[model samples]
Target: MEISVRTPAVEPRAMWSHSCTLDDLVTPYAVDPTVVARLEAGPGWARRWTAVWRASRARVVCPVPDLADFPTLASAPVRSFTWQARQRHRPGLQFVLATSRMHGFESLEERRLLLALDFTGGIEEVLSQPFKLRFTAIGGGEDHTPDFLVLLNGTAVLIDVRPGHRVKDKDLVKFAAAERAAASAGWRYLVVTGWRRHVAAGLDALSARRRPMADRLGLHDELLEMVAERPRRFGDLVEATSLPAVARAHAVHLL
Candidate 1:
């Protein structure tokens, strides 16, 4: 007797955020027209951005005027990483299923943000340390690099990761500069303070089944058929399956 194996099913994107809590995690930054004009005239605005927008190995110099129409999804990180001894911050790489690439992160909070973005889905591309942003804020000349540049539904979103309490007065200045630049380029800006209650925990649990899984026993189809009628409690849904123990993992994948 011969047994045939089927290809594994792709893991569905996790929708861990609830409607009520989405606002708490994502905070948009807006500014008045005067500040926007000042930022555009500053050095950061006059200076070109260093990015790899065309080829993976080649870097492109982009002017601020061209940013609104730049194809960010095709871009690469502005700079690479080299770890040194006793670094105060934790630096690591995370493999994102969305882009099938290992993204670099300078800190643990960045790592979590990557996971959340990956699970959220609809992101075409994610580039770490995407560009070197130089802007003159109220204080004086300030040079900064944003954490990540993500393309969602063909729109560019510039993101910075900083805990609410950790954000100081100077940090706000840099953020404001970034926000203004991002706006000038027709891109959205967001400061992710932190996740809402239970969102992190839920993401952890769902990520366990984030990879492809083989339905050797045909339990995936059976599980779906069972839930076709109406929504069922997770515990009860798994318990009603043909093989409850194995179905638990499949059920989570189906979610």
Candidate 2:
């Protein structure tokens, strides 16, 4: 059987400045409280966010690409992966954005990292498998398609998720090409890994606060005062709010 491959016919334009840093180019995505509340109330909230609550809040800095002028990758053919029967049993996830559109994930890891990014107070937009770019001139040229394209603060980031142990020689070449493509476009490229453990728990804890009910019950202001005064346990913080048990529970989550 004959198989055909697609490639970029023209070289992409170099739009990004060499001296710009990721932080300077892209800001983190902002949280939408309404959207968070909706997701929290939806079915399977816990399952969806298992890894999100474990990722860290540390800012990631790198070179960014300029994606505004590039064509969307949606036109590219979808790529397929071959895995053993055991791997096929892994569940997929769908992320619902503030806009109510859904972005699908093929693995739990991808879903978790995406949730973390969504929960991040700094990220503004998240797109999955947005596009593909070719890196070589030969037949059946190598192509790099990032897993997610996110708009952080004000900058764009092209992210790829993989386990730390799975990164190999070929992956390095692909990463290098991705880096070059991202830098040229004034966007940042990221290879996501086990770092979700750093921020997920904190995010899950704070997600409850995104509900407007927290504001209505005065839990918002009260918790702020208590935490600002001195460090307190989550339970104590909840009790200090003077809210009822249910409200206290919500307040505790906010803390």
Candidate 3:
């Protein structure tokens, strides 16, 4: 009996963000905040954001522009940086703009870091490798749909293939719910964006099982325990990590 191989689903491309350090891109427009508010939900797989604009009246509002001001925005005001990070979070893209003024608030170096994320695409490759499980790549499914609900080792893993960037409340909620559910299910859950997107310069096949990720996530001992003890589902993992949402899901995947 031939076990016909199944294809992993193809994910859609929504409005992913683009990072920029340009100060001229900042513009405070006046519109009914409802639309902006709805858009401010940022990009993700959820469909409820439309309702937010339905009840909103045409009110004058200043929407913080996209990551156009990320470079200068950090230097301008922490509040501005935070706001941009929240508004410009595209579901598909990384929007990798750093608001940190670390290392004596250096400018050139920060830009370089941001540039590496934008051009080199390191985050997508690195992050994607750890989140995936071994499976035959029989390509099928919708091109415009969100990632398919994946089951690895009999555990559900919800993947959102966005790039590395600031975390938002909406995205946080989905990831959080997955984390909560995984803890309840004692399963593995992950949001694999960035790093993998760029293919880590196409080294995915070579370094798919790299070991450094365990150290980065700080999940060495916990992983050892879970595999040995065997979690039943999400709930078990949650209890094991005592972690909530994305962090919890992350811990489960680490194992």
Best by lDDT: 1
Give the per-residue lDDT of model 2 (tens digit) for 1-255: 221212224433343323323322222222223322322223432222211110133222222232455433223213333356667534455544443456666677677666565444455666666655554421234656677777766567877776555555455556655655666667777766444222446545655454445356666677778778887776777666677576576664554
Error of 3 at 145 (Å): 10
How much lDDT does candidate 3 score?
0.30
Q: State the TM-score for model 1.
A: 0.78
On lDDT, the stronger of 1 and 3 is: 1
lDDT of 3 by residue, 139-254 (tens): 21111111323333333343343333433434443444333333433544444433313334323332233233434555556545775786346566656663444445455344
Q: Pairing residues by index, what is the TM-score of model 2?
A: 0.58
Q: Global lDDT of each model? A: 0.71, 0.51, 0.30
Worst 10 residues of 2 by lDDT: 46-55
Residue 10 shift from truth in candidate 1, angstroms: 36
Q: Model 2's lDDT to the true fold?
A: 0.51
Ranking by TM-score: 1, 2, 3
- Runs of candidate 1 exceeding 4 Å displacement: 1-61, 71-75
Q: What TM-score against the true fold does each predicted structure earn? A: 0.78, 0.58, 0.23
Find the 10 residues in a row with the least total lDDT in model 3: 47-56
- Root-mean-square deviation of candidate 1: 11.5
